[model samples]
Target chain A: MTARIGIVGAGLIGRAWAIVFARAGMTVALYDVDVTALDKAREAIRQSLVDLKQAGLIEDVEAPLALIQTESDLRRAMADVEYIQECGPENIAAKRGIYAELEAVVDSDTVLASSTSGIAASRFTDQLSHPERCLVAHPVNPPYLIPLVEVVPTPSTSETAVNHTMRLMALAQQAPIMVRKEIQGFILNRLQGALLNEALRLFRDGYVSAEDLDKTVKHGLGLRWSFMGPFETIDLNAPSGVVDYGQRYGPLYRDVDRQRGDDDPWDSVTLAALDKERRERLPSQGLADQQAWRDRRLMALMAHQRTVTPS
Target chain B: MTARIGIVGAGLIGRAWAIVFARAGMTVALYDVDVTALDKAREAIRQSLVDLKQAGLIEDVEAPLALIQTESDLRRAMADVEYIQECGPENIAAKRGIYAELEAVVDSDTVLASSTSGIAASRFTDQLSHPERCLVAHPVNPPYLIPLVEVVPTPSTSETAVNHTMRLMALAQQAPIMVRKEIQGFILNRLQGALLNEALRLFRDGYVSAEDLDKTVKHGLGLRWSFMGPFETIDLNAPSGVVDYGQRYGPLYRDVDRQRGDDDPWDSVTLAALDKERRERLPSQGLADQQAWRDRRLMALMAHQRTVTPS
Candidate 1:
């Protein structure tokens, strides 16, 4: 049975979600509050689908594009949809209103998931009668290019909902990881946050330049990171395995941690300095071109990734 | 004029350095204290060069292999070498002893650098007759595959040595980042240590599983990090650039950092748990095979990187 997916906001993420599901042969109903945004979304999604086809990421883009139906009417979009991915505003009151209307319209069995980056589902779903179906299904930006989806559930979210979402994501060719509990920034951002914290400090202290620090990742740590994680990186570092690696380097890490000291790692002065450096390299006006460059690189990487099989 | 490079230790890093310099058209003299290790280094280096050639990373393995000469005597290897990369043991005494010998044999114009992972160059080079020419030229394991070389200089190290080393590294097609001041673990490992520290804590607290955390990177953040750094990622993340990204998410990172608390993030309990998980996924004996797999993936990524122009 082909499942129907509802995207309740025709913004960047909502439209991306539409492509994700549509590409998987699911029927996607994309809705937005503004009629103009919905019209714009249709053209943008069409162009994006073609781009994916050109990149060899998808074959026969018209089939997926045909699967997505853009509608301005919220209730019509929600009706009979087995899953609703809310991509609305991040505000609590705004989400509460959206959820209230969604709860009234969608069936009891419909799984409601928020594409919120950090907001816990419970905060907004607490008042809903069907909170069991509500959870956070956060995808890294530009989900069509990146495949990771963080499925974070609230206390009230049902196992059925979480499992359904996970399975659906997998079917959509997305790699979904469970977040057992809620924490600020979730796993992806937290890890990124940790790295950024140190990077900012390093730049602030004049230990390394912003460009060099960027090189440290692009040309160094990130090469391994693209395919292997931190734990796996060390697991293969030593001959014996992870335990051997930990035994050898744990103390060094501990020593560095202590030396790192407990200070507010993020400060405005450092950010300003970093901003100046970044802007000098990439002027704000050239951001769109740079983003397109990033997208192209991502497509190339994903294409290359498909050719290699990991042991 | 092509520089003649001397490798003091024929270990994993030494052999990898041989490929890096040799492939860049530099004549390499590889030496080790133990004659057996030197022989082993030659075989390993030859095999590695062939692998890189097979992976299409190098055009002709024989050319680079022919450029590398294995020597059992230290002075013979050091004589007339324009640059010496010491891949000695990561212990202070061992490195100091090696540096003392190198100090006597190498010319004053020759730049002496250590491939020590953790030990500071200043610690070993402090008492040398010419401390100005000595610094840390730390490369990621398998420099031919990973091009990042953290060129760290001590307080007494001369600008001439730093610039010379930097130019040589760039000439060797390795991305070299300057570490203005000596710090523990330098920039690469410290940033890695910071990420690993939180990863340990997160796994310990059961916020996410070891595999999931790894997935969070390989499938997500690492994709971008593979080419762009955290600062650049955020710079493009928001329309207005780094300052804009900082303004929007700086508070969130700060909040997460506060919630992170000061208790040491690396605990033994978590390492054990992580080890179990890693060993389960990849058994103790399978590490070497997995490492080869990682190398193949890295080569594929590098090949793909060469196709695109970084904006």
Candidate 2:
């Protein structure tokens, strides 16, 4: 009686999704165009499950991996599946082809979700016969550790599509948010862009060094942001809270926005400075080791969050 | 042999700062224009210290509170102090007047820093004879738990003033970042604004609910961000890590910026939706209690972070 899920494109993201779904007690049918990719993806998914098990993230991993089956036929993956997660490439033409193929074969009750970051659901769903079920359930990279899945819909998309997608995502052990309309980068990407843009502006203007700039977030504002949003954080900022903090500091942010009109810091001077500072702190050779350490650290953090709060 | 740190205001930030400096083993002299404010501030500081003790944030409250001495005279607060942290009103006229008064009283060797969030250092330090000693030392709302202090300097400001202030902040158990030149909103505010701005845009454009927007951060990015920074986070994102992740997603972020023209959803509407969601999640009458819960949760999270990670 468990929900049966189908995942197209058994690459890194697709395999990750397979793990997520299978870990949540859903039988996943993962498919790829090439049989070689399907073979490799199965091994990768197994290895990743082992990693997750080692990190104490998953239990009964062998059962989940055993539940995931690969079929030579594309339509075989979607047959009798309650949900389908499409982690196809960013190309519009490829997505169109896949959608067309999927629409022709996917079950009427199946929720067809795209893992696309930028493409609007309307872009491809405009031609779909069952466009109501088509939406973007884009997840941040390494979705297991970071569980923000942006569920963006189009005008043709139905409310049931949104709710069912959310419910199915919950079953997958992912936090799903509905995007009422289609936007460029969804939510997480755009929010992330804002920070990167401002960091670049500060560096380009020669206001701070790259290392200190990063530290400003890691040691300072980030300390609070790790727990609360900007709005809630601002609320507790002043005596009267949000309104007071806004009245005092809104003008300052407005001025900053004014001063930061269309400035790109990827130029030679700024890049050189960034490289210089980056080299001083993190060597190119040690980048790999540092990254492994970061992943381990993230694993530890995730373990802490899971045990302290709810996983 | 300890740093003689003089604070010009006795408000919450200033008092918490007194605890920070005193706990770090320094002589903190506090002064206020109104004795009534000072008296109330004393009670508030004592209560806060007790709360910190209860929260296990501070170890010895009595000794730290004992290190603070009240002075009625401006010269007494300004004289012979290694560093002066000005936490007066953010109004330009008030700061200008204080700068003039402190200029007449403070020795040239003493560094004069402000806790102003809005006004630039150049604006208030324009007419001061020793403007070289003036700089911005902005901190988060509660400086004790959150240790980020943004140090801003004008073009005419001396390097020695910057270095001395940095050293002094270090002595106070604060992580200070020096803004090489004055820019709007400094580092933390701008980065935060960037994220909030994009969130506002996504909401205004009918992309996501306000609650979902906040969760995108709190659950998604905030998980790792609580421990590492955006740059460091990105560095470990891809195979080659940050540089690789940047190369992959940087262009995509730029494209997102290009698409967010003035056609997004409005903040007021989103805020209304957020308020509605907030009320549903927690009764409006219990907001104050919820905020206490939030702080306790933060403390628990911090404690968990310590047990999980070394740094």
- C-alpha positional error of residue B93 in candidate 1 after TM-score superposition, expressed in Å: 1.4
Candidate 1 Cα outliers beyond 4 Å, as residue runs: none
Maximum-TM-score candidate: 1
Model 2, C-alpha of A310: deviation from truth (Å): 7.7
lDDT of 1 at A207: 96
- lDDT (tens digit, per residue) of candidate 1 on B1-311: 47899998888889999999999999999998789998898889888878888888889978888899999888898889999999888889988888888888888778999998888889999998899999999999889889999999999999999999999999999999999998888999989988888888889899999999999999999999999988889999997888888888888877656766555755667778898898788877788788889988888888888877865
Candidate 2 — number of clashing residue pairs?
9
lDDT of 2 by residue, A1-311 (tens): 39898889988788888888888878989988889999999898888777777888877568888889987588777888878999899889999999999988877667899999778878887898789888899987777767778888888888898899898888777888877767677778778877787787687677787778877887776766665666666555555554455556655655555565545544456545665677678877887777656666666666656755431
Kindly report the interface RMSD of candidate 2, rounded to 1 decimal: 2.9
Pick out the ten consecutive residues of candidate 1 chain A with the lowest summed lDDT. A257-266
Interface RMSD, prediction 1? 1.2
lDDT of 2 by residue, B1-311 (tens): 47888998898778878877887888888989888888887788787778777767678779888888877688877668888888888789998888888888878768889998767889998788888888999987667767789999887789999998888888777889988877677788888876766776665556666678777887677766776777767766666645556667777766655565333233345445555555565555665765666666666665655565443
Error of model 2, residue A82, in angstroms = 0.6
Clash pairs (backbone) in predicted model 2: A179-B207, A207-B180, B204-B264, B204-B265, B204-B266, B205-B264, B205-B265, B234-B242, B235-B242
